[model samples]
Target: MNITLAQAEKAIATAKEKAKAIDAKMNITVVDAGANLVAFGRMDGAWLGSLDISIKKAKTARYFDMNTGIVGELSQPGGSLYNIEHSNGGLITFPGGVPIKNTKGEIIGAIGVSGSSVDNDHTVAEAGSKAI
Candidate 1:
């Protein structure tokens, strides 16, 4: 199932809170199960460049139904998914992307955060995903 607009908004709000807690200005993107943009937020002073990265991260997570960091892991040199980022237009095969699952444990969408360190990005994304 896809994420509802309400759920998407909640995700963004939670992500923003986490970003603020970490003193990070972030570009956050949430995409539905079909990998369509559902919501987005760019905190003041956030990097313009990171906007696209956030969107790609969300899509990458939904496209694979897994955290983008996991994809990054397998895409390392000599790994099974090496060079996989080159496919599907382009992918941010790094931290900051996470799948959003419903109470039923079914993936509904994904959240992506950028404009900070990967660890902070992932943390924010995790916070957002858990909102639902």
Candidate 2:
């Protein structure tokens, strides 16, 4: 099953609303289950550096089928799956990434956001996921 553009648009819209509410510019990325890009958006004043990081976070979520924050924990110094992150093109491991699960509880995609604090990023991504 493929993720529809409409779903991606909904997620982006939700993210934009949340980011605006917090007065923070943001870079947002959405990826399919295979980690392919679905959609992207950057607020007017978002940092350029966040573009790549946001995409990487979504890819990381798709690759692991889990949130990037959990991936970070697993890839940490003493964690069991530490070295796997290095093999997947070195995706960013952080909390800004979240899986988009279908009603069946299957992950259909993921969302990622950057250009703000980690907490804000997570908030935006969560809002996007709920919108979808």
Candidate 3:
């Protein structure tokens, strides 16, 4: 199953709310099951450098079927899945990415957030995932 347009919009809205709650300007990106862009939102004053990071975070989560933070944890030096970020044109291995699952527990899409600290990014991304 893939994420519908409405779901994507809902996710973006929630993400924006979370960012605002934290007084953060964020770049949020959502992607479908096939890792295609579904929706995106950039809060005012968001860092320009985070645009691609947000997209790549969503892509990374969808590509691996795991949160980017988990990937980052296991991808550390001498850890499992290490060094694979160098493949696929270099993937983001940090936090701020999550898979969106359907009611039946199927992954439908992914959400990514950037333009803040890693902890804040993860928090905002998790908020967006709730819209699934």
Which candidate wins on TM-score? 1
Task: Give the worst 10-residue stretch by lDDT in candidate 2.
Answer: 81-90
Off by over 4 Å in 3: none
TM-score for each candidate, following the candidate numbering:
0.98, 0.93, 0.96
lDDT of 3 by residue, 1-132 (tens): 999999999999999999999999999999999999999988889999899999999999999999999999888989988887897777898999999999999999999899999999999999999977
Cα error, residue 52 of model 3, in Å, equals 0.7
TM-score of 1: 0.98
Between 1 and 2, whose lDDT is larger?
1
Model 1: lDDT to the true structure? 0.95
Per-residue accuracy of model 2 over 1-132 as CA lDDT, tens digit each: 556789988999999999999999999999887789999999998999999999999988888787788878887888987766677677888789998987778888999999989889999999998886
Give the alpha carbon lDDT tens digit for every residue of 1-132 in model 1: 779999999999999998999899999999999999999999999999999999999999999999999999999999999989888899998999999999999999999999999999999999999999
- Each candidate: RMSD: 0.7, 1.3, 0.9
The local distance difference test score of each candidate is 0.95, 0.88, 0.93
